[model samples]
Target: MDLVFVFPVNLQKTKVLLSELSFFVNDEPAVIGLSENSDKLVWTGRLSPQKVLIFKIEYKGRGLDQFVYHLDPSLPVKNLRFISNIRGGSNYDYAPGVIPATAIEPHDQNNVSLTWDYKSLEAGVPVGLILPSEKSFSMLIATMTGRGWACYILFFISIVILTIHGGKKLKFYENYLISACFGFFFILLAYLAAFMNFYLAYGLSLLAVSALLYFYIRHLLASATAGYVVLILIVLFLTIPTLAVILQGYTGLIYTLEILVLLGMLLKLSTQRFFQNVMEELFGIL
Candidate 1:
């Protein structure tokens, strides 16, 4: 990349000192030189008050993610312009605080040209570009794990409350242990995602946790029917909600509808006195 700084001549100043003129690229020293009449010069001669001063810097590096240009506030610049021409296959976007480009054009094969211009510009915030890359895995995992934890907590609490209301008594310790196991499922998934593909790790983790819960519910209720009911609850409250989260932008709508549908089903079941009769018969309270 090449940067050119054009400073207009100050009539009152007799000489422009080259000692104070310097620039760094990527925190490393850059080659700075003077150019006059479109030709490179080994040394700057006496100050020409009527002529413009141009300083050119040349830099070479790999994986250049960002480039920042800061204007010195003390210097009087009549016009400031930046022209960027990057090779193909690399897409770049202007960072915040950067002045908008005035013109964008296609340069030579696989090259894009970008130009930024400002009249009577002053220094403030630095301007730069942001390079492009693939979607971040850490971000995806954070989204999934956050949603997963919420689903697990809701499902665990609902199941425990339903079991108690059905006249099947469970010790407080048992409830705590079951909930702990359910919460651990997401922790396991978070670690597994580091070593394997996220989707594959999530599926395997869900299968293992679901199977554990199925047998645990069967033992607690002493009925195969109760075990199947718990499995259905897992699918409706946990599995389906998790699928919704994976859908990204649509997750909010899907999760809201799922909660409403689940609530309606519970209300309908309660109005039928289904749970009340089952509790009465199971506990011999009737």
Candidate 2:
């Protein structure tokens, strides 16, 4: 890959500082052939106002994944362009920035040309292109499933506590099995997502698990009211929280507010003597 920076001459001795001009070739640092002073590529030159100075940097790299160019905010850039030739099944995609004046993929040759023309340019966001990867979707699913485990554990604890407080005479093994089923919902969604849309798989898995758990809870507690309560808790604490995690960026705030609201409701309910009386009657202590 090669990068060229063009500077407009202003009839004054100008020194351009170049640091962090390192590139990796085949997962190793590329050999840079430049005179450096204290790890800085110092380019000094003097030219007339009407002249332009061009600096070209060349490097050879293998297995390059992405190329990012961060414009120095202090420098004024009039125009910037990126040109590349694609090969070996490598494709490119860019983020939001100055739209490329030329089409990236040309049908005649496996090459891409992009230009950003500006009357005057100020440094803003970094512009970059991501190289193609095979495991992008798989990695995404893995991350989502890993985070979902936390939600599963939270739901399991809630269920166990609710069952115990409701005075259900269930064995330890049965409770463990119920919790396992709740955790399995996420695993099911993960595999299903590989074959279909993620949201669709998530909805289907949630409905299946919720229905199964509702009936199981009703049978275990011998009360329709207990089953409905469990269902509501699963929806509020498990389903919605999992969705928030998947959405990203809103997970922390959503979870904090959810826990606060739940705690507030618990405190309000605890103040009622009826709740204490029921607990005492069921457990016959405290």
Evaluate model 1: give its lDDT: 0.64
Tens digit per residue, CA lDDT, model 2, 1-286: 2343322212222332223355433345444443433332334435556664444444333334554556677777675544444443345676556344344555443444444445556654355566444334345556657776676776665575566667764587887878777877777887887556677987898888888889998888888987898788787766878767676788788878888987997799789886665555546532
| TM-scores vs. true structure, each candidate | 0.49, 0.49
User: What stretches of model 2 exceed 4 Å from their correct place?
Assistant: 1-91, 94-150, 277-286
lDDT of 1 by residue, 139-192 (tens): 766666677667777786567556765557668887886777677667777788
How large is the C-alpha RMSD of every model relative to the true structure? 14.1, 15.3
Per-model CA lDDT versus the true structure:
0.64, 0.61
Lowest lDDT 10-mer window, candidate 1? 9-18
Q: How many clashing pairs per prediction, in order?
A: 0, 0
List clashing residue pairs in candidate 2: none
